[model samples]
Target chain A: MIQAVVILFSVLAIGGALALLLTRNVLYSAFFLLLTLLGVAALFVLSSADFLAVAQIMIYVGGVLVLIVFGVMLTHKTDPLNRSNQKPNAVLTNHRAWLWPVLLAGSMFAVLFQMLRQGNFVLLNRAAKYQTTVDTIGRQLMAEYLVPFEIAGVLLLVALVGAAYLAMPERN
Target chain B: METSTILIVAALLFSIGLAVVVVKRHAIVVLMGVELMLNAANLNLVAFSQYDPDRLQGQMMTLFVLVVAAAEAAVALAIVLQVYRHYRTVQLDEVNDLNN
Candidate 1:
């Protein structure tokens, strides 16, 4: 049952990423990103990282993706009252540069795949088992990883303030 | 799920993200690609954490990564918004004022 879910969500994730790549409209890309994020969240569930899964959905899908869509809408000049001429929603680009990225990413994947096939990961991971990670994670975060956890909080606060400052329009 | 299977999925995601970042012209779309790559790393971390039952280090790292990714997206989008306001376009090729 879990295997089936893993496979399904992985497919959903890969497919959504591919769709986002192929789509020209930024709005469509944002929606496709939604699919990808949700799929990743499900994969987290299958892997038994329940808290991360919930955090992924709440933070990525509920927050960042919405902000992306809003960025798309705000940046574009769309007039709701006028219907005569709508600006292009699709992004324009040079087609010639595409071959290099495909080659680069493809070679990287090929290298990683080869490494995975040859490595001793399977043997080393023999003792690992699936279990709910939330409690363990919480205790560790409050204990061993306390400093980093507090730093993360501080980083988030700084980011919030900076983002607000950067995004706010000039009064003059 | 096999460990190798999850790793392969992460590989696919990372590559697709690289492709998106490379091929997409819009800054926002490139940011999306970056998020994809970040999630790919997070998946790998969680999968490995499943193997090491003792420390749960992988899950901890994934949490930090999530926080960082959110911070990055916020600041990046704000910069992108400001860029659009000044340059009047978001395409990577055309937004080059330094080259001109």
Candidate 2:
């Protein structure tokens, strides 16, 4: 059942990613990106990374996607109905650009496939190990990794302030 | 069912991300590409973490990556919006004023 769920989640993730890539409407792409993030969060849960999953949903879907949609809204003056017309000629040019991504991605996959086949990964039965619960992760975050955790928090606060400053309209 | 499957999925996600970054001219699309790449890395981390019984460091790192990715997306989009206000377009080719 777990394997089945993994397969299903992978399918969802890949599908949402593909949607994000193929959609021309920026809003649609953002929504699909949300789907993709949520699917990955589900995968994290399946992997027993429950805290990470919650963080993923809260941060990426809730925070990042909102930022992207706001960016779209602020940048584009047209309503959704007319925004499609604003596609720059450069985007429409080079119709064969799709082939480049396919080729590049294919080569990357080939290399990674070879590496994975050669590597040694010991897979243990999930039932045998003690659960990696959120409590343990919280304890570790507050202990050995405390410095980095606090540093990350400070970094995020700085980013928030910087982003607001950069985004504020210039005064006349 | 095997580790190879996780690797394959990760590779696919990475490639899709690369495609989005390379082929799409919109700044938001490029940001999506970055997000995809980050997710690919997170997937790899979780897959590797599954191999160990103790030390869920891989999962922890994935959490950090997600947080950083969110921060990156927020700042990047804010910049993109600011740029659009000045230039009216998000196409990379046209925004050449900063080019030396």
Q: Which candidate leads the pack in lDDT?
A: 1
Q: Give the root-mean-square deviation of each candidate in angstroms.
A: 2.6, 3.8
Residue pairs whose backbone atoms clash in candidate 2 = none
Against the hidden reference, what TM-scores do the models get? 0.92, 0.88
Q: Score the docking of each candidate (DockQ).
A: 0.69, 0.58
What does candidate 2 score in Cα RMSD to the true structure?
A: 3.8
Across A1-172, the per-residue lDDT of candidate 1 in tens digits comes to 7677788888999999999988877888898999999999988887778899999999999889998888887777644575355555443333227789999999999998898888876545575566887788889998999999999999999999999999999789
TM-score of chain A of each: 0.87, 0.83
Q: Give the Å error, residue B45, model 1.
A: 0.5
Determine which window of 10 residues in candidate 2 chain A has minimal summed lDDT.
A88-97
Positional deviation of residue A153's Cα in model 2 after best superposition, in angstroms: 1.1
